[model samples]
Target: MKAIVIGAGMGGASAGIALRNFGWQTEIYEAVAQVKPVGAAISIWPNGVKCLNFLGLQRQIKAIGGDMASMAYQDYQSGQILTRFPLRPLVDRVGEFPYPTARAELQSMLLDEFGRGRVFLNKRLIQLEDNGSQVTAGFADGSTATGDLLIGADGTHSMVRRHVLGHDVKRRYAGYVNWNGLVEIDEAIAPANQWTTFVGQGKRVSLMPVAGRRFYYFFDVPLPTGLKQSRDTSRKDLKRYFTGWCAPVQRLIEQLDPMATNRVEIHDIEPFSTLVRGRVALLGDAAHSTTPDIGQGGCAAMEDAVVLSLSLRAHSLGVEDALRRYQESRVERVTSLVLKARKRCDVTHGKDPLATRQWYHSLEHETGEHILNGMAETILGGPL
Candidate 1:
């Protein structure tokens, strides 16, 4: 069988790899001429790690990923630890390790594994047409490909999704803007094996180690919609916004290269009842975009790849049946997760000061075991 996958991001590449592993010929297309990963760090929890393991990438990811032993929440101004949640117990319970990895590194690995020949760049999808027996994808460069199946793994602003759903969908903002960058890790600032966050006043500064003794740090601030910033002014804005933060955070901000920092307004899509129509199916952010508060966006995409492959294998001779099964299997799980992540984002941003204060105090009283169980709930519930 032949499959055409739109969007060569992690989800699309993984879909191509998974389909190929199941003995299907898969071709992946990317709109961008050259892929440049924008996100700084990705927390690949055990669930996501398991998906990579299914793709035979666990060992390679571990080699390039950083180990996070524990997580701590601190006061942004005084740098006093509000609570410390150890993660080693979760590893023992789940029988899988969670690692933080650079987005570029992971993307490069997926590309290498998926075979570069199978991936086509500069192929922006313009339309998708599904006849009774087959589907065809139209590209902006006047190229077309017909296949038995089409996978829309394109991201939040997915063209494939727009085509499949037969309408344009607007992304809903998650009520905050985030600034992300990778900076040199210093032992004096924080320990390497810890995911540390400084929180206060409806804002947060977080840092986690990646490979090569570098930390992927991000700042989240509640801001108005449609706000824009240039590179030079964005750096200055970061400094001004975080003036009262801890010394380590201030130092980290100062060390960041103005041109290297990336500022983005976080957004997610509303839940859809289904992810498929005929031979076309949506996966990852294209299917159900979620806020990054829980770090499950990419992880969910990876899970979609595995489950969709399983469905195809089950209905090898029935492409439409496979798509129906894919939608039936994934819609409920991903929709609930999308809503959960949205709630988490709301709590983190704390649009209401009083509620936010209460939320922080509640975190102070949370036991390590409670936190571990919460993490376990998210990771252990994923598809095997």
Candidate 2:
């Protein structure tokens, strides 16, 4: 069987690897001149790590990934710790470690595993035609490629998804903007193994460790969609937004080189009722784009790759049947996550300030065991 995958993000690369593992010839088309990960960092929960294990890349992932020892949620203004939780027990409960990794490094690893020669860069998808038994992909470069199956792993602005779903799906803004960058680790900002976040009044500052003694830091502010910030003004604007946040947050912002920062307005798609159409199917953000509030966006994409491969194998590559089963198996889980993440985003951004306060107050009394168990349940519930 031959499979053509669009977009060379985690989903596309992982889909290629998973399909090839099942003895299918696979090719990936990426619109970029060179495949580079968009974001700064991704927190790979146990569920996502499970996908890597299936692809036999766990060891490589661990090498490039930073393990979190703990997390501290603090009051944004007073800098008081609302809750401190250990992460080790959760790791033991799930039987796999969660990793905070640099997105580019993880992408490079996946591309290597999938075989770089099989990925065609700069091939922006124009259209896809399913001719009963085969699917043909038309590229903007005036090239055409055909395969037994086509997987659209393109992200939020997915062209393949537009073609397969036969409609223009717009990205729904999540009522916020984010500024992120990488900087040398500063234990003064947060412990090396701690994922520290300061939150209040619809804004947050987080500093999380990645590999190589570096930290990926971000500022999230509830703002109107389409708000733009120039580099000269971004630093000053961020400082103004996060005024009186905390000493560490202020210091971190001061250290940022505006040129190196990435600014984005977060958006998610409404969950698709269907993920497959004949010989073509959508994967990752293409199928179900969700807000990154819970850090499950990329993780969901990784799971999609594995689940699609398993479904294909289960149906013995009976194309349409496999695709149908894949959709049936994934829709509920991914949809639930999309809704859950949206809720998290709302709550985190002060949709109900009173409720957020109550939760923070409640966290003071919650035991580490309780917190760990709740998290473990979510991570362990993922596909085996």
Candidate 3:
């Protein structure tokens, strides 16, 4: 059997690797001429790590990922620590520590595992045809590929999704703007082994350790969608929004190169009722895009890869049966996560002002155990 994988991202590459492990031929396609990861860094939680392990990339993941030992929440203005807790317990319970990695490193590792030669670049998918037994994908370059199955790992603006659903999916703006980039690791900004965040006034500044002795940092502020700002003015705009914030935040704004920072108006799609139609299945942001509030966007994609592969391996009825089983198993879980992340986004970004204030107060009295427990619930709920 053969599979046509679209997007060549974390989801597509992993799906290719997984399917190949089960004796299937795979061709991965990418729209861009050169593969560049969309973001600077990503948090691959324990569940995502397990999926990578199943795909035989454990060594590569550990090599490119950061060592995160603890997490802290602090006041945005006063810089007082609201809660500090070790992550060791969560790792112990989940059987693996979350890997905070540079997006480029992770993408490179996945592509290497999937075999660079198997991935075709500059092949934007403009059409998909699922004729029961075989699926064909037509590219803008006037080339076409046919396979027994098609996996749409294309992202939030996925064309494959429209084909499967027979309509376009609307993306919802998350009512915030985000700026993220990398900086040299500095203890004065945040501890080397800690994920530290400062929150207040429906805004957030965070720094988390990634590999290479650097910190992956991001700032989030509640703002209107489609508000225009240039890269040249990102630093000035950040300073204005974060004025009178903590010393670390000020330092971050001052030290960060605005030209290098990526500013985004975050958006996510409503969870779909189905992710499959016949031999075509959707994965990653193509299926259930969600706000970054919970850091599960990529992890969920990894899970989809693993589960889809497993479904294929476990079912003997037929390809369609296996795909249906995969859809049935994932819909509820991904739907719940999409809703949960959206709720968290709303609360954190002041969509519910009272709830946001209550969240800050709750953090003050939190002892880390509750937070770990909640994380454990999400991590353990994986198909692994």
Candidate 4:
């Protein structure tokens, strides 16, 4: 059987590889005219790394200088540790290793596995049709293709979702904007292979090692009740907003040489009740966007690809049945996760210092077993 996977983002590429692994013909349609990755570091927890390993590309990812270590959560501004979780420890416990790598590196790794012919660029989804025997996709350039299945691995603002599922889900602003900075390699701020977050009143900032030595940073701050990402904003405005956000944050803003960093805003999609709809389905941020608070956006997308392929191939390549299985298997798990991730953002961005402090203290007392169990349960489909 054949499949058309839309978007060509992390989810799409991962799904395409899985489908091909299971003896299914797969084609990826991407809207971008030329595929070049944006953003810096994206985390791949054990749940996702297992998929890469299954696809036989884990070592390739490792070769890209992925960071393998631990993550520390702090009081967003004061840099007080609330919790520190060892990623390698979780890997040992669950038999799944988590690694952090540059987005470009991952895309390259997956693309290498998928090969050139299976993925296409400049192919935007205009519509989707499923008239019993097969599912079909129409692109913006007026090209159309029919396949046994259509996977909406498209990110938020998914066209396949609207055309096939008849559901128009919108991105919900997270009451804040973010600034992304990929800093030069340095000993200060972030050491090699460690992730850190500093949380404080109405703001939070994270420093993660990308490609080992380089730093991938994102700072979150409250957005005016109904602000949208705009070009009208100025550097002075960002500097003013992030004023007094503690040491490194203000300093990071000062060193923001890249133009896009200051304008970055956090947006999430409303969690859906189902990702699979007929022969069409959704994955990645398209299906379950979340505040980047926990850095699971891409990881969950990768999981969807593995699980979807596993289920689809389980039924002798029954595309429709597989999609239904995918939905039944994933919705509850992904939805709960999206909500929990959002709550983390809430606590990190809470305006009340006292309340936020209490939350932080409470989180510190939270046990590693509880965390491991929770993390395991989120993707493993079992109680830890």
TM-score for each of the candidates? 0.97, 0.97, 0.99, 0.88
Which model scores highest in TM-score? 3
Task: Report the error of model 4 at residue 382, Å.
Answer: 8.1
Better of 1 and 2 by lDDT: 1
Clash number for every model? 0, 0, 0, 6
| Residues 1-384 of candidate 4: C-alpha lDDT, one tens digit per residue | 898889778889989998899888899989998887657667776677777888778678667645757777665456566887677666777786667777877888888889867678898777778887899888889999899888887777778667645667767777777766567655456556767777656666777776746777776777765555443454576667766666666666666565655455677877777677677888887788887766678878888888888888777546678788888887887887788888877767774567767866777886566766777766565211
The digit string of per-residue lDDT tens for model 1 on 279-357 reads: 9999999999999988899999999999999999987569899889889898888997899888878878986778888
Worst 10 residues of 4 by lDDT: 225-234
Q: Candidate 1 vs candidate 4: which has greater lDDT?
A: 1
Q: Pick the candidate with the highest lDDT.
A: 3
lDDT tens digits by residue: candidate 2, 2-23: 9999989999999999999999
Predicted structure 1: clash tally: 0
- Residues 1-384, model 3: lDDT tens digits: 999999999999999999999999999999999999887899999999999999998898999999999999999998999999999999999999899999999999999988999999999998889888999999999999999999999999999899889999889999999999999998988899999999999999998899999999999999887777978999989989999999999999989888889998999898888799999999999999998888999999999999999999999999999999999999998998899899889998999899999999999999998889988998998988
- Sort by lDDT, best first: 3, 1, 2, 4
What's the residue-level lDDT of 95 in candidate 2? 87
